[model samples]
Target: MANKKPLILVTNDDGITAPGIRALISVMKDIGNVVVVAPDSPQSAMGHAITINDTLYCDPVKMTEDADHKEYSCSGTPADCVKLATQEILHRKPDLCVSGVNHGSNSSINVIYSGTMSAAVEAGVEGIPAIGFSLLDYSLEADFEPCKKYIKAITEHVLDKGLPKGVVLNVNLPKLKEKEIKGIKVCRQAKAHWVEDFDKRKSPQGRDYYWLTGEFINEDKGEDTDEWALSNGYVSVVPVQFDLTAHHFIQDLNSWELND
Candidate 1:
């Protein structure tokens, strides 16, 4: 008997109409059966947050006149979309889940705040092999043509060789042309952070407000890091595990004299 088509779930932080997710959908269409459940509006930097205190909505949407595939516009975080997709939307658990092809970078320390990666992490928690993709460019018009081939390749590879439990891939592509991209590299997350500054101002209504601004700081000089790969024209693939346990420090922590 021939093998059944793999069921794939597609989602993003940039809403249902973003060109990035469209590119992702186009690529995924060739790979397997795809169903998209993404935010109705941009939800960048939402982390792994899920809606609790408010009503969540996920409704059918038409992305294009000729496009044929199940699509839903969700009123929740990226994580919430994944939860709803698996629990209520999809008829069955997806064989794979992919998020983003985001309009900006989710490399280095940015993954902790990325709704893109969070969706992938959420799928990982449900035992689904997942990947979050991003481009370094912040432009809405950024060319995603270069990313399609790699996306197809990586997705096929994952389907053929399933991922380890509790792990998901965080992939970031440089903003260079297809020819300029050296290759894909498996690397570590570079030690990096955002140094934020808030612009405090009074609104015309006499209320104080703040807008966040920051500069990215990359402190790690290691060549085997995502930051280095992206800087040198390579696609960076970081294996992210959702486990937050500090296992190495557990023994030392237990030795502390807390009982006294």
Candidate 2:
């Protein structure tokens, strides 16, 4: 008897109908049995957030005429979509879980706030092989053509060779044409941060509000970093883990005199 086709769970932070996810769905359909559970609305920058105070809802959605795949839209964050998919939607554990093809880049420190990576990270926490893909372009109509081939290739590779337990992939593609791309590069996450600024304003009714904005500062100059890979026109693939423990400082922490 032949082995069953891989069960691939599809999701994104840009909502189910976004072009980026549609492109992702198209590619996954050719590779395996794809099932999508994503936010009903864009959930960008909602990092690892789940619904606790409110009831969650997930309903089947028909975004395309493709009969080979199933899709659902959830009224929750990207992370919640993953949890709900695995626990309630899927009949069995997915062979692999994939998030994004996000409209904007989730590289460097952005991963800490990205709903795309959060979804993938949630899957990793569940011991599933997962990946989150993103493009540098942020436009709602950004061309995703250059990313399709690479996305399919990377997904196929992950399905063939499972990721290490607790580690998920954060893949960021440069905003370059397919011919201009230098290929994929596996690298470490760069040390970077966002410097925020808030613009204060008053409405006609005298209510004041502030709009938040920031600039990304990349302080790491290493060639083996995700920042360098994306800057050099390569698709950066960073292995991200959910473990937040600073293991290297454990010995130093133990040496501190606490009972004194």
Candidate 3:
């Protein structure tokens, strides 16, 4: 019997029309039947937010006249898109879910605030094999050609060998030419954070507002980390889990004299 094509859910934080998602959709079409549910506008660092305070809107959108995939634009976060897709859009549970090819890097601690990885994490929470892809470049016009092969390879591997429950992949590519890329590296998330600076400014009406900016600082000097992989022109793939429980600390907590 011939095997049925895999059903792949596609999404991103850069909106339904962003070049990043478009590039992702193109690659996914070659591998499976793709259905995209993404934010109508950029949702970048929205994390795992969902719509609870206001009405949620999701409508069919025509990305291109000849595009093959089914696409929907939603007035919600990336995480919400995954939830809605599984609950409201797809006829059956998808075989796999993939998010991003995000315009900016979602490596290290940035994953905590990344809408891209949040969508993938949401899928993992629902027991779906998932992955989130990002490039180190932040330019709107960044070339994604270098990532196509790696993305397809990783996606194929996940489909062939299903991921463990609660685990999703975070894949980050370097901003290098295809030939310049060294290879793929499976690694751990690096210990890093942003040193933030808010620029306070006054509008013409004298109202003050702040613009957030930050410098990324890598505190880990370990070579077996995602930061190191990307720095050396390799694609970094980190397995991420949605469970935030500090299970290792529980034993120490039990030893504390809290009962006294």
Candidate 4:
């Protein structure tokens, strides 16, 4: 909180070259010194995977002709990228770590499988405040201009007020024009899930294969949830915790007749 600009680690699941991350970097640069260490290729839905057996190769690269920020492309998952950045790349702990501006929504139950959120969670595990951002549009050419201003505001807020330990933010922007977008909304994650099915098929070698297919179903009608906020034209900001403990069920589990 001194005169020096904060160091911000920028990363994403949608590869280093993805437009989403590029847009994210533009916003982060305005707030702090940025160091980008992201996947060299798309690693969406990869969860919190880390590279153990295989070799991780990370090298600095220039993304644009006039680029001034430190950028590195890594051959690893989003989680691995954070680990490498903290352990090997950056000389000091970053003031904050930010992921995504992802090509699609990472709201509701999708968080479990999101590489974007996983990176932020990984940062949280390392005692760094973090946030993961996403947009409703899944297209590579999704218009990101409308979301940049909100992203800047949210990032500035997080920088001002550090997040709680073990907690990070999951932000989702609706695909709407800048003027049509409602203001930011702090909400809880919706109770939603995918009713998934695989499409069976045959390859050219006559081998069987299956492609993943699913429909997202939102069972909760609560208006205070992330899904509802996004549906109603606001940017959804959900505070997420990396802890997976089922603390509420511990008391009930103790009542089980185990000695009988």
The lDDT for every candidate, in the order shown, is 0.94, 0.91, 0.94, 0.96
The TM-scores, one per candidate, come to: 0.97, 0.97, 0.97, 0.98
Question: Tens digits of per-residue lDDT for model 2 on 50-154?
Answer: 899999999998876756578899999998999999999999999888888899989999999999999999999998999999989889898889998999899
Specify the poorest-scoring 10-residue window by lDDT in model 4. 251-260
Q: Write the per-residue lDDT of candidate 4 for residues 142-225, one digit (tens) a residue.
A: 999999999999999999999989999999999999999989999998999999899999999999999999999999999999
**In model 2, which regions exceed 4 Å deviation?**
none
Candidate 3 per-residue lDDT over residues 22-103, each given as its tens digit = 8898899999999999999999999888889988899999888997778999999999999999999999999999999899
Which stretches of candidate 3 lie above 4 Å from their native place?
A: none
In terms of lDDT, model 3 sits at 0.94
Using lDDT as the measure, the top candidate is 4
| Model 1 segments more than 4 A misplaced | none
